[model samples]
Target: MDEDTTLLALSAIAHRSRLAIFRLLVAVGPRGLPAKEISAQLGIVPSSLSFHLKDMSRANLVSRSREGTFIYYSAALDAIHGAIDFLTENCLAGAAGNPSSR
Candidate 1:
């Protein structure tokens, strides 16, 4: 991912609620979970969860789909991996046997 995208994803996950939400979605797998279920599981209010989901979706860190009356949300694997790579990109920058620097 590019710098801007990485920054957006990081900012989106910087909050405790959002982090928990992301982890919850990841644990749920690609099948995803309905918005109501997510809010209930995370102890978040529906309105707050809606705000969080919107921010995450804007960052491309999460995706949403509608199934009949349910709005399902899923963690975007590529975005998660991109954030991880962004954090570890410079790992062991000056250390030996760091394979990462290679």
Candidate 2:
């Protein structure tokens, strides 16, 4: 991921409610959860949940689809993995020693 994308994703998930929502969606896998279900499970109001979902979508951290009248939201696994890779791309490159071998 580029710096801007990484920053956006990080910022989107930086909030407590958004983090919780992301975790829940990740746990549920690609099948996802409907908006009502998500709001109910997280104890969040529908309007607040809508705002969080929009933010996450803008950051490309989450995706949504519609089935019938329900809108299901899922964690964007590829984007998430990309962010993780970006964060750890050069991990421990100049450490004092091989910490893993210690």
Candidate 3:
């Protein structure tokens, strides 16, 4: 992803509620969780969950699909992986061959 997209994603996750929701979705895997189930699991109110999910969706961190009557939210794996890559791209820069730090 581009820098702007990465920043947006990072900004979206900087909030406590959003971070928690993202982490929960990550733990749950691609099958995802319904909004109510997510709220129950995270001890969050439905309205609050809706707010956080909206932010996450804007950042492309989470996606929702209508499965009958329930809207299930899943982490966008590509966005998550891109964020991780952006953060770690320069890890231990200039020390790739250094063994002592290992």
Off by over 4 Å in 3: 90-102
Error of 2 at 79 (Å): 1.1
lDDT for 74 in candidate 1 is 97
Estimated TM-score for each candidate? 0.86, 0.88, 0.84
lDDT of all predictions: 0.89, 0.89, 0.89
Question: RMSD in Å for candidate 3, one decimal?
Answer: 2.9
Candidate 1 clashing pairs?
Answer: none
Tens digits of per-residue lDDT for model 1, 1-102:
777888899999999999999999999999899999998898999999999999999998899888999989999989989877876674434657656656
- TM-score for predicted model 2 compared with the true structure: 0.88
Question: What C-alpha lDDT, on a 0 to 100 scale, does residue 94 get in candidate 1?
Answer: 60
Pick by TM-score: 1 or 3, better one:
1
Over the stretch 30-92, how does candidate 2's per-residue lDDT look in tens digits?
Answer: 989998999999999999999999999999989989999988999998887877877776443
The candidate scoring highest on TM-score is 2
